[model samples]
Target: MSSVTIEARHEAWPLREAFVISRGAKTAADVVVVEAIDGAHRGRGEAVPYARYGETVEGVIETIRSAAVHISSHADLTRFLKPGAALNALDCAFWDLESKRTGIAVSARAGLPHPIAKITAFTLSLDTPSVMAEKAARVPHLSLLKLKLGGTGDDLRMQAVRQARPDAHLLVDANEAWTTETIGAFLTAAVECDIELIEQPLPAGHDDILADIPHPVPLCADESVHTADNIETLLGRYDAVNVKLDKAGGLTGAMRLVAEARRHGLKIMIGSMVATSLAAAPAMLLAPYADWIDLDGPLLLARDREHGLHIENGIIQPPDPQLWG
Candidate 1:
């Protein structure tokens, strides 16, 4: 009488173009995939191992494999794995497995409304002012744009992109590349560029400077806050929190952070690391609660798997069950 079986593997998908951030560049998204099988039902989950979080694909798969034998239920998953890429994949797998076995959608199980199509922020990789402007111009149809910013000459980059796409909603992500000397000027540039939000202008654990800075544009915490427990400490520093399943363990843990953030009056940004639609699908369940949606991962890929989430222009339709919940 076999109960549930677990399996995990790594996959690499080529990017349409190099994804450049303050951290560096990547031409491919290497992801870890988790599977849970029970009788004739099968569930899947995908997560990108982020190097910034010190997670590698090999390490993530190993962790999942070692803990697989002990995981049979949601509570068992939590007890066996700590929060990270490994746990996130397993948690999401459990969600899909439950939905498959019980015939209940994830949103219904969690008492949330079914996901509807929504517009998402299309990201422009970090580049020179002129290059960034050209990239922004290429996507003239996209109404929302998220710019990957590097500190030294970011003001000109913002001005350039904004000039090219005056009709677009602008969001800036420094990826913690801005220094104290540059942050002041950068904040002013965001105002001049009509930027709506800024993410992680300074490094985590070194973001105290944000307390004294006057935010003409709202700041959102990406690297600073991980779990629900980190919300209260970020009160004055950030106006919002960016929730990524990779950072929060999975949908289960992300909901905890979302609830905590709302309680403290912090707005939410539902975001993701560049991966396939499989990874993006589960995050969409939380989209209704977000002030901004940055789940354009599939659009950045050279090609995605069949039956993936359908995103056209800048609007994304909810995931098809053939893909996942």
Candidate 2:
């Protein structure tokens, strides 16, 4: 094992300038990258601004800096970190570093045969019905599209995208924007559109309404399902769960979530924040068991760190660890 030193850095990217979302994100993209260096090997990981988690680039940098002293002293990746953006980045960097050191793949480290690249959902950020339809039509070889839903009239948006791309699989992410009354109408439209899944329509604490609602699309728990401890309460409410390494805190929590979610028959979706490729690489281990994939973090970025994961069309390839440990 090589002695590793870790450092964290932040970068800002300007959006297309006109791009905006219901979440009020309009011009800038900021992310924090964690780098772990050992001898000639360097591994990297990045995390985005998780609005739900109150994470800014500076906050994540501060969080990682607080742990740098502890992480640099520990050689074991698994025991070195906790979960969240800071730990997620560092944990992934450690995995990348170890993979390079051992001359084996990340799948081999986790006892899997090989990393199988799978079709992922291309996201259509919140936009006008016509604009979203146009965006959806442009994505090539895309079987799945995750539509960001949180506007006044999602039925029109959903119908427009569906009409535009009748052959593509569709899913909706409301980002905790639905009310009890609007959910029925929203779901009705999704059912008519033949949507496959709906994620976190209602806010977490008020999601009890889902228990009685008859949803045509399978419901996926995103904000509702964080760590392994959440699976029990989430059993009857959601048909699937979105597992992001950031929310799970690190690989240790994510592995536990996969087992616990399966024990309850909840379908798994390995998701990620709008991070660089480095952040999504480590979570690729969960790909084998996931029913859905949303590792499109780097795809959303203007440019990724060097030697990032390869993405072609909608399929995400395995990571090249030369960029991060």
Judge candidate 2 against the unseen true structure and give its global Cα lDDT, from 0 to 1: 0.79
Clashing pairs in 1: 88-249
Q: Residue by residue across 77-161, what tens digits does model 2's lDDT show?
A: 4464556777777776766666776787767786754777888888888888999999999885788999998848899999999
* Residues 19-61, model 1: lDDT tens digits: 9999899999899999989899888999988799889999999
Candidate 2 deviant stretches above 4 angstroms? 1-3, 14-21, 26-28, 72-82
Query: lDDT scores for all predictions?
Result: 0.91, 0.79
Pick the lDDT winner: 1
The RMSD of every model to the true structure, in order and in angstroms, is 1.1, 2.3
